[model samples]
Target: MIRIAGLGLVAVLLAACSGQTETGGTAQAVGAAGPTGTATVPGVPAATVAFEGGDQLSPKDPIVVRASGGTLQAVTVTNPQTGNAVKGALSPDKTTWTSNDRLRYGATYQAVATAVNPAGAASEQRGEVRTIKPSGVATASLFQPSSGDFGVGLVLGLKFDHDITDKATVEKSFKVTSSPAQDGGWYWVGKREVHYRPKEYWKAGSTVKLETTTFGMPIGGGVYGGQDVSATYKVHDSWIAKADGKTHQMKAFHNGQLVKTAPISMGKTVDTPPRGPTPTFNGTHTVLSKVDHTIMDSCSYGVCEGDPGYYKAPENWDVRISNDGEYLHENLKTVGVQGSDNVSNGCLNMNTENAKWFFDNFNAGDVVEVTNSGGPQLSINNGHGDWAISWSAWQAGSALRG
Candidate 1:
């Protein structure tokens, strides 16, 4: 059954009965009790209209005709007010016919169908329909990450304001591709949200494309797409830095090749008062943006400036990767402890030289994966955390993933 989510509908299902049989058209003889209690034959033509006379309809509903006899000869759906025909297509076998374009709401339409028998005879039928008026229009809202330069795991995210009941019609309208053309799929992350990603991590210097014809598409009884949207993302160099707190090491990869292995200090495993564990989160992330220098305040983490937990410093070469305030930056006065121990506040602390090298080479969108950090994995809603979920699990979120 087709589900209707929060759609205001007029209660008139669109099917009408055509009495018995007709001449000249291929029909089956259905045995029936005659008026005089004798057996009689009822004619039911192979071709018939899908809508009932004077029935209230929806713009998203299919305007169809069923042909079971020989083949579909002709079908015409037109607005009586404008005298323009609604374009439609016939199935290969000619057994079914359907409208190809969207119908208009609050408008009256007339549908006429004809099918030929094997004997060259024709069967004709016609029906009138009136579409329902919608209470509100739902539009698609795109939530793409940073547009400039990005890491290899960036995804194009989209969210809608309303629930969708028609998955096939709506999903088919999307067209996501790449300049070099990489295979990818859209996963439903929520009832109103979708995320698009390639089968593997995107290659460096590749361009991703996103297009949607969902505008004006009927998604439910009364809901239609509000507008069309498109975007292109530029993938920069592959700069993936993997940090492990337990091993106290950070490995940087460039274009699938190992580039550098720097001894680093990560967050501590113990939790402090007012602030939770200083450990870094474990999972995939992306470099959202970078800063040359910033004032690092201990009070931001609920610690007083003069307290034992409070320590103020001007941080250097900061690269933010998550909304939880984790960063890959330089930690002055801690170069000796970096290689041998974990002793910082949820950051990958590097020496000045290594931090300067990292700051010069990396940009927004570079993948930064952390592991064994003694913290929870980054969530899908986190900064560029779309790659944290498994592919099979991610695909399950889509409405059309069946």
Candidate 2:
């Protein structure tokens, strides 16, 4: 006789039959083939399997799996080469399983899902996926004051397109070198931007170089995009002057040497402006920022006369003298009354050539002193030309302290 065993194939049969005489005693025929039959066994059912939609991911990302129409008995993920295993458990619905830990990058992983039905029939499903390595770190850009320009009063700025999770790794890849050593430091302006500046103005003749080796760095969460970049800049000769409205005369210096003397006109005591009790200038001031302009008679220092300071101007000769709106430029129309008479609006009227000569000679750090201007010395926050701040104060703003 044939018998079927539950869902899996297993065979068992009677060895033999004995033959005996008839009469009243009964015996089975040995070779009679009484009930020649074959045994049938059912095949194990296949378990339906699938992966969650987010299966494709970086090494630092998670993996999820789903199975259907069966009770999940065991779920495991393994690396075929190393036999390393990741343990996973079935969800309450018995159709889902997940691995919380992140997978290794650039690796292929296999998942074996085991399931059983109420009939105690066992089945298995297999799945495979490859985890990719994190993306390469992107390049950082040199920010502030574009290359190949003259009279750029800007800090050395660096900006990353992506947020930097690994600060040490990113920092290690950065380097700044100047021909003449500068007391400088990096300050984090934002997650993507950083600024570097010296405690004082750059040396008159210096070459600056910046480099970043950002490729392949794991910036954050295993996602990185950085490139190797380098830049070199030449520091030009320039002068930035500070003027106090309280001081009436302007002194010009070249490379720390007193060079020229020019009489200046300042805001009258009655109309003292408030840059700081007395108006002042700061940072590396430049000359001749622009030239030629129209003049508007407007209320200044709480005083606006219909015709008080109205003059159709020549080119706007900009000699950045103070943090406030003070300058030492040619005021040809008001030249006769500059020093002896504080007749004009708050500007030091100089001869045009003198103004041009001063502009041409002075670099970013050359000094111009203005007295009789009623204001405090320029503070740090005033302008890009904020050279007035003491060296100690400037050093305090560094991100990397040594």
Candidate 3:
């Protein structure tokens, strides 16, 4: 008689008439269509196997195992060549199993699963597959300001080394937080640079942190990210200056209260030839850098240093505001015109005493907003000139929608 199995063959027979002993003795053949395990319930998973299709696979597809008329008893997917089991979880009912880890590219994988019915009969499946080979991998570099007190006009920015076709994916991997909360938005200035600035100036003494997990991320063009990025900074003070070229005056404020007002000479608007339109930038600017002493030369502006109109003079108290050569420093030769008129290349000019006083009083990251000049407005890349971009226009450039 056949044993308890659905296959068209018997597992063993008692042979009650042929056998002479009281114990069972006869033997029978096992069915070829039975499960891989010895329990021999039915055919291999009966068409419900998750990987029934032939397995030349994508890198991201999950390896799965399922049962038709039974509960899953065992399932394990592994990279045979590496001997590493792919991590996965089984369903609560124990009827299904699937891989949860991201598989490595250009690797071969194998899976085996066994299921048993309520009647104790069992079935199983086994298969192997190979994943696609990659053509390229992407990478990028990150930049963040070192730990220091920044000007009130603080802007957090990032730079990538590659052309990212999937911008939203790249942006989603970053996180930004601040103490004393801030209302800020990130703007994608160009294809690769994203800048985040507050709607108003950052609150004084606030701490901000920016982070990104793009490293190892699977970017487009088969490129992976370079490394993780993170940085924290402090907002120092609220020293804001409104330098009005039209009024030939500058007013400095400390903590939102007026502290000092000085008559200043801004760049001229065709008030003199050769220096025509040397009118200072007419928008918001941040103090880029400072030099205790340096030679002020016209050669930097393309004028020959020794030319009749060009002068190379060693000046003191030079605080730069733009990469295009704008400084708020004493103009000894034109000190007479400073309070009286706008003369000198696009810079905020002050008398020797006043210039030295302001320079010594201000710190890095101070704001120098040159207004009332009929000149070109400051640009996004013009030395921390993030304030030059309007808030609305800036928000429109973000990968995240308004």
TM-score each candidate.
Answer: 0.62, 0.48, 0.66
Clashes of 3: 4
- The runs of at least 3 residues in candidate 2 whose Cα sits more than 4 Å from the true structure, single-residue gaps closed, are 1-146, 149-154, 159-173, 188-194, 214-229, 237-247, 267-269, 272-278, 282-316, 320-327, 333-337, 340-348, 363-372, 376-382
Task: List the lowest-lDDT window of 10 residues for candidate 3.
Answer: 12-21
lDDT of 3 by residue, 50-134 (tens): 4421344555566666555557777777888789998888889887787887776667777766655455543445556566554
Put down candidate 1 lDDT per residue, 1-116, tens digits, no spaces. Answer: 11112222112123343312233332433234456533323343444335432445656666666665556678788988887889989899886777877777667777767665
True-structure Cα RMSD, model 3: 10.7
Model 3, global lDDT: 0.70
Candidate 2's displacement at residue 258, Å, is 3.3
The model with the greatest TM-score is 3
Q: If the candidates were sorted by their TM-score against the true structure, best first, what order would they fall in?
A: 3, 1, 2
lDDT score at residue 353, model 2, on the 0-100 scale: 64
Of 1 and 3, which scores higher on lDDT? 1
- In angstroms, the error of model 1 at 35 is 74
